[model samples]
Target: MKFVDEASIKVEAGDGGNGCVSFRRERAIPFGGPDGGDGGDGGSVFAVADPNLNTLADFRFTRVFRAQRGDNGSGANCRGASGHDVDIPMPLGSMLFDIATSEKIGELTRSGQRIKIAQGGFHGLGNVRFKSSTNRAPRRASPGSPGEQRELRVELSLMADVGLLGLPNAGKSTLLAAVSAARPKIADYPFTTLYPQPGVVAVGPFKSFVMVDVPGLIEGAAEGAGLGIRFLKHLSRTRLLLHLVDLMPPDQAPLAQQIRTIQDELRAFSSEVAQREQWLVFNKCDLIPADEIEAVVAAVLGDLDWHGRHFVISAVTRAGCEALCAQAMRWIESQAPRSEQDLMDDEISAAAAAAPDAEAGDEDHRPA
Candidate 1:
């Protein structure tokens, strides 16, 4: 049940059965012709997305997967039994890649979705197939073909409607815990939440949106600082981003500069992600002096050249949290239903296109 987001594995398809070479021998017939049957085809390897799964921990222990080999052909023109296929179950939002070629195989975004990772070998031909008028009672038979083998990298990204972005201890976990059933580890210290946590935020009856709390981002996060570039790719699928800023930080690095630092990191990560719809959220309002709250908000807005929607809330007290959730739900509901598969495909294609550059140490942040 441990949360494992990434894993590597090798898969091998089943080998086809060998063909039989035989001729009929009957008392009534003087000369018998070739009557051997063809061999059975090998089994294939497939990966299936299951909604019940939320992690890739299952792949951690088992790194090698191989399908069953087909049975050998029998005498008297009897075909061999086909091999059983191997199915690997993974969580929804799993992305598969070819490690050697760096090719994007596919992404699983919906329940029951499946993709063939390796193809089975073809069955061998029997002597009966080689029999003809030119050569009667042929004794020729073809050997079975070998199955396909591949080394793959599997990574999981949690699917959500809204993503929380901010520096460490910006109250993202508290917000998620307050609004939904997800119970993330909470502490006053930074980096308390190491992994992504998902929750269902309900707006009304039959109206809800998923929210994801990603790990904290440091100033040089795009350059592999802090938690490194491991979890940033999870933000690509989010429709809206909530940029949380601590209004009153004990460290006293100008609040405006802190906001800018996060913005710079976002821009450095990906321009496409930077241009996504983002709302400025000033958190920890309760700690801010009553008279200085407005001044601080105005100063931060001016520093960022603000002309967009913003909010001020305290995640611990649940102050303004409801409104924030409401607004998030409204924005999510307004946007078109972006196909999860299409988005994942785009990400994979982008990664594949940048593989060469990545190999050359191109400082590009890609999902591991």
Candidate 2:
């Protein structure tokens, strides 16, 4: 999948069938009335949410969508066949906006959800309908009305319970692989993960939540210094953010400033993202000497002025990963279920919203 999140398309409804005009003729009848048939109704156009889809990249290939046209009516009081309704399949979290009116017309968050994009044209009338008391013989029939047509813009935002945030090579991929079945690319280089990868982390039997791993952030990322601008929107839908910090950074990196760099970027990008509930997680503890681990942790905390919830884990060894995931599951269980309306509030990505960022993250990272 190319992972395209936005697309635009044109849709048109089917046209109605035309009416028939004819008069009944019989050898035995002295006078016969009109017996024209009515025309069939046109088909409407609709957009449906499909659970199997995850991106709007497919929309790039086909843009125009038209419904089936109705069959024309015939004489002898025969009605024409109605047009078939056209239904388009799209991924969940995708929203449709009207181009001309700039209106938020429809949003598809749940599977099997459908919304009408255009209405089919009305069927035409027949000459029999024009017969009146004053005018005994009618020779006129109405034409079918044209179907509705319009252009629309579609935007997709992936929804998740938890979002992982950190600098590049922050062990995001390793942690996701440890906690779930997702297999993200793991390398020692920065910017190894280019996009967001989601996985289901099971806390217990039948208890789990979706976790999205976004690309790493570097200094000045909010200013488009790195790939952060492209993927920052992925965090907006998350209820909680897990900030992973590398304990044993290469070249003896500054522990305190490492956390602050990510923080600064997030705040600069969006206030909502900066203000979210973020839990500081010290990663790669296995790399630190067992004897000096306590002192190093204490020093890192002092540098960060840490007072909030914190955790120490090693993704490579799977140490403390289970406990961390368990706690996350419990936290999600305690919080209220998020409403679909919340997804519309984020403006982090190309789409504007009131929530956090718009579309992406890979928090399981920062190389050891």
Candidate 3:
């Protein structure tokens, strides 16, 4: 399936049913009172996250969604049935936004998580509700309110533990294939991998992490160059970044200069992403003579003033790939948990902390 990261959709909630204003007409009863039943509430619209889905292509064809209207109220105290709610299945990690106000509704980060996009209209009142001592035979009934309608912008951000970054033909896909089971297209020409591909890299039994490989970036990528920065959002949730560089390339630019170009583009795209912890991985080390490898690595590191961890690997030969994977797993494990459990706990704590303030506000508003 063609990966679609963004899409626009229209959602309409069901409208409430109209109330009835009828009086009971029983046999031998001269003063039959009002016994009209109330109308049922309308159905709402919600967006649910589906783990099996990874793209928004399904929403492209079906751009509009409308729920069922509520049933009308009946006489003799017979209530109407409510309308059924509508559930929209969207990919996990999808963010919803209001197109008119550009307000962020919420993001679906967990499987089966749901967020309400539109609310149903309230039910109309019946004549019985308005009946009082003076107005025993009330004839007026309020009409049902209209449902909420909204146009939403859906954007998907991939969830991964590690992200790959580099220029074209830098052996990123090769490294991914060597370390994991993902088989992205490999070619000598640039732009072979047109989209982002995620793979699971297992360091050992019961120890693994997800890694995502996006299309290689180039100079002026932030300014809509080759492939642009469209796919970069896939890395927004990643904890670590692995920057791949070809040890030997056809271009005459220095290795340090090549690295700097990618860095500038990354910073241009997202400053927060540029602040992520990155490790330099020089690929195709087998092409360089063994004795000159150390000197070349040293020169590039010194020229770039890099102080972080670096690795020399041959992706085609699977050399040094194991160590890289192991280190990545360890680093990911060392970081703070980004799981749903922690998020839920934080929310609970926040709500608990706010309970006292709510009580205090109630006390302040109490009758004196």
Q: lDDT tens digits, residues 257-301, model 1?
A: 888888898888889988999999989999968798888899878
Model 3 Cα displacement at 227 (Å)?
2.4
* lDDT (C-alpha, whole model) for all candidates: 0.88, 0.86, 0.90
Q: CA shift at 119, candidate 3, in angstroms?
A: 0.7
True-structure lDDT of candidate 1: 0.88
CA displacement after TM-score superposition, residue 183 of candidate 3 (Å)? 1.1
The 10-residue segment with the lowest total lDDT in model 3: 186-195
Q: What is the lDDT of residue 91 in candidate 3?
A: 88
Question: lDDT by residue for model 2 over 1-368, one digit each (tens)?
Answer: 76787789999999998888888888997678887877888999999999999988888899999998887778888888989999999988887999999999888878899999899989888888888998666887787788999999887777999999998778988999999999998876655577689999988889999999988899988998867477787787788999998887775778888999999998888899889888988889898787887788789888778888899999999999999999898888879766667655543433544222423233334344
TM-score of 2: 0.79
Write one digit per residue (lDDT tens) for candidate 3, span 1-368.
Answer: 87788999999999998889999998999899998888888899999999989899998799999987777788998877888999999988899999999999999998899999999888888898899999999998877777899999999888999999998889989888888888888876655478788889988989989998999888998999988988888878899999999999768579999999999998998999999999999999999899999999999999999999999999999989999999998898889567999889999999999999999999999999
Candidate 1: deviation at residue 5, Å?
0.5
Backbone collisions counted per model: 0, 28, 0
lDDT: the better of candidates 1 and 2: 1
